[model samples]
Target chain A: MNKIQDIQQFLQDENLDAALITTPDNVFYVSGFKSEPHERLLGVMVFKEAEPFVICPLMEVPDLKASGWNFEAVGHQDTEDAWEVLAAAARKRNVSLEKIAIEKSHLTVERMERMEELFEGVTISRIDEKLNSLRNIKSEDELIKLRKAAELADYAIEVGCKEIAEGKTELEILMAIEFEMKGKGAEKMSFDTMVLSGPKTASPHGKPGSRKIQKGDFILFDLGVVYEGYCSDITRTVAFGEPSEKQREIYETVRKAEQAAIDLVRPGVKARELDKVARDVITEAGYGEYFTHRLGHGLGISVHEFPSITGTNDLELQEGMVFTIEPGIYNPEITGVRIEDDVVVTADGVEVLTKFPKELKIIEA
Target chain B: MNKIQDIQQFLQDENLDAALITTPDNVFYVSGFKSEPHERLLGVMVFKEAEPFVICPLMEVPDLKASGWNFEAVGHQDTEDAWEVLAAAARKRNVSLEKIAIEKSHLTVERMERMEELFEGVTISRIDEKLNSLRNIKSEDELIKLRKAAELADYAIEVGCKEIAEGKTELEILMAIEFEMKGKGAEKMSFDTMVLSGPKTASPHGKPGSRKIQKGDFILFDLGVVYEGYCSDITRTVAFGEPSEKQREIYETVRKAEQAAIDLVRPGVKARELDKVARDVITEAGYGEYFTHRLGHGLGISVHEFPSITGTNDLELQEGMVFTIEPGIYNPEITGVRIEDDVVVTADGVEVLTKFPKELKIIEA
Candidate 1:
């Protein structure tokens, strides 16, 4: 994946003097270094001709070097502004600081102002689209990491299914799932692990609470895992005890919709096509309004990335693109059901990374 | 806490036409609603006179209402730009967009540009300082939530201590601690749960890995919990077995430094004073160079908030202000030891919210 080369080519083709890549995800993508700087600054500065350099908190220098980034890494003390360091470092390359590009959507107003103040008269433009386009297609190495993440996510769902029992609180099951995941060498959950049960499941983004799982409760486990630097997201809803007719109907409808979306994932297929296919499946089952929100989002370094699967996005699916196909029916009066699978677009068709069964699993408590 | 009224008063005093609060912490501080908007926009538009309005994704409108935001909550679909919805909602207030204020430190350059494009000739100024000042002091209810969060964090450390074993990997101990926290009803960790053991403990901000803890090694548990909206951060390092002379010296130095800083916490004392007191202690121990980074940061809605406990910050301590007092001595050639505590400035002295003992514990595991 000619990452730095791709960014350098973008700079040269656009006639921009340089590009300042902020945002931890983009920084990691460019430099192969991972550091959650939080309030501190971490940037990857690429040039039209000069070698790229990194500017980060002084403490993270060793980490950057360990990450295989051999380029100059300028370290700033806590008291110093990182932009000043960046400007000084960029000047060291003897390049004119004019017409620079940046991650406009990520660089804060405060930081941007600081950058402007440091680099006098520099015209900045957005490089977000270029970076997003470059990161959209995953490489074979990234796929390997994603596949491992998906395996752990599937195991989390399996643990959630096993831990579901009568009188067990939603968080109790969540704890068991996360505990097992960490023990299995998962770095961390891609996002907050969700385990919702009974009526709580109807809340589209429900927080696991002390509400105990009762008989006939439908337990929904939506969780993911981060393996290395890649992420995988999976959602699986299981029925505890025998489910009611309405619950069974909702579960089957979401399963069909999710499968419909998964089936349309291939090269040249528009992202919107998958959304339309899934939406139609849910709409035909008379739960169109219940199936709210978009069908899916691209998944890789971040659990949610680019090329959103919605009815309006016209982006064509490309091979090596990994994403989640999650379609849910949240009906408070009836029941909530969602089926999710992490899939990677393939040259032929698709490879579903998440192997967790989509069929209804009614666990006997 | 008279939060909204305080914001309105600030707007009136500053002669601001309106304020666009975008950061989730500030939004939740002003209004009761909380959301992780991810890439989508979540903003609270407050005026000097007009009722505050919230703009969020259509899917989160219900959650916003449930969170007790009774005023207008303009919900935007996934396809719609939330900034457009926010602009329309502000226009409906019939107030001049001129002389608006924004959280410049949190708002992205892209969003700031969008605002300028939408509201032509709008003069925007930073309200970040005002917001931070307003949130500096905690109320009775806020303190209650913080205390609960601290209690949970202490319990987490207790769990970690019990789970420590000779052959256990760092991740195994971390899993046990997090599992206990989740079962005890922590919303989530304020940050990633950190459990570093042996040589890994020397790496400040090290990720818990499969590194096994042998006999003579230091185990550091640095984690926090988010209770309701408040956050608590605590770091405690313990010896798995009999420590070396250097390890003991480092531990004692950091503990003394942390205690010295905590002892200096009172009304009217400068934030820098505490940092100096801690820094001085470590310096006198001949480990001045080893102790890097700031002493701590203000803790409340956000784990790392305003009034960063740095030697350079001149913020004055006041009653009801909550923050962490952490001091560490990280010498890669030797070992690392850190001790942290959550403390609240009281009328007379400081109330240590984190009750975990600071005394070094030598666990014969």
Candidate 2:
């Protein structure tokens, strides 16, 4: 009832009758069920100024019995066409297919064509941005999971920092950290655990390899953890020896910039403007071009989500939205330093969730 | 040049003038460049009896330089604006838009509509099945990597089986095996390591959890190793004690069925017919309904690929086709047993790539 009401409010404000969600993340957002990737099913949550109904495959009815949802179950055999089941659900709900809005971002050509053929007179419009907007604001349950995910990442890096040393390959370090995370009950890594040392750290998304870690190398570990279907991302850099004056200065500048970006994250602030706050600082420090990728991205069900923290986006920050504040300076031949933290937007300020020490640490081999 | 000729011959046989490929796997198959997912970039490999041209983002050019391919590379930033790039390539090739075929299976709706808009006169017939046919066969280079992947999986599981015990949790076993695989230089896992024990093994793809191992429980470990983008899959079941008579009976039935399925695979045989070899064996044993999913799927760049080993698919097995022959039986409340192996169809017979010991092993906890 609570999720249905939330959808009703979202539809009323977004001016949509019903949303045909095909993305598992969006479906999980609306319905409580978390399906495996190969489920090959679509979940439709419709709002028509009343309680919403979840239309799913008939085999999933037994799984959803405890969800306390209203009944509109349609179980069909594999040989039975899915269109017939969907059409029957539409007729039962008295939903005018002409007003149905579908997520253009996730809908495939095959599925869209099948839907068009099933409801011959239906009007299907793109409602992708509206669904993204609904997901932008994190709920209480989401924040709880996000915070735990951040804690897991923090603990993982703590293990990685202790295990990283000279003669250890980047691949070895990555495996060790992943081992520690899985030991602590992480479902899986949010993404590939990036362990780049020295010159290899210059690339934003470098793959971990057998390149041996050596003394005087600047080690950068960018990793994340997936916990309870939510994701947390964090990156930290350390010097394997006494840092050069240049490395020290660059690390301090990036630390200040990352904290500055996090400080600007509050309700009613423009996301792009906050990006510029950190960007301008690095630009003044003469490392502007080196910071090539976006400042951050909204994270939840997927690793990267909408409202990119880039100069091109004009979306406003709102309370309950959680994102990352990662700022870096990469020089291909010399060194790379990146510091990242997960932050949740609050009414007055921001809450930093990750607690891994980011201050440039000097580790001796 | 050889791949280009192969596609040209395929296009000529199909009576198609040109074909547009947008799927990343298809692109990688043709161009040898693996791209990032969910990006605005498109890797279009076109064929018309000449060297293939690759249309991709501007940033990938540096990486492509090392491949030594004969492709004419065109780079573009805007996806909508990239149609002109494709059009210019087509115009340069002296091929008009008509009679063009596209990979319909992988094309997104947004890109499909754009292609239609720019090349209004072209007939974009679905060339999906043809592309899958080409990808089904593996090249010598691909087989070398697959063999290495299989060797890594074999060694890792051998190490894993030694560590299984009564007090170990499923998650612990998965991590232990994954760590051992990483130690052996696997870039990543082909899929999530499924380590299910006791009744939990009934679910084909059960998530590893905190459930501790117990005496006389069926321990199923389904895992794969990814080495240099090639995948290898293997599954083995172990009983913590002397398995019950019924358990041994089920295990033997699955082993026989899996071996029979492997024996049936060869050039010129239909994949579905091979699936029936296993299905019939399990069905005749009175455990037919418990084998819920497909027998197997093609294994290559992606863990699960084309030419699904299901009764409905009519694709014929080719000499270089590599796939899994996994036959399983799940008793809802009792236990489950699955024995899977990677098989490569040869000219005269099939070669099993997965060398992991499949016999039911009784181990003391």
Give the top-scoring candidate (lDDT): 1
The TM-scores, one per candidate, come to 0.92, 0.90
Model 2 lDDT, residue B291, Cα = 88
Predicted complex 1: CAPRI docking category:
medium
Who wins the DockQ comparison? 1
TM-score of chain A of 2: 0.92
lDDT on C-alpha atoms for all candidate structures: 0.89, 0.80
DockQ computed for model 1 against the true two-chain complex using alpha carbons: 0.61
Each model's fnat? 0.80, 0.20
Residue-by-residue lDDT tens digits, candidate 1, B79-169: 6777778888898888877989998889999999999999999998999999898889998899999999999999999999999888888
lDDT of 1 by residue, A139-164 (tens): 99889999999999988888898888
Q: Cα RMSD (Å) between model 2 and the true structure?
A: 3.2
DockQ of each: 0.61, 0.38
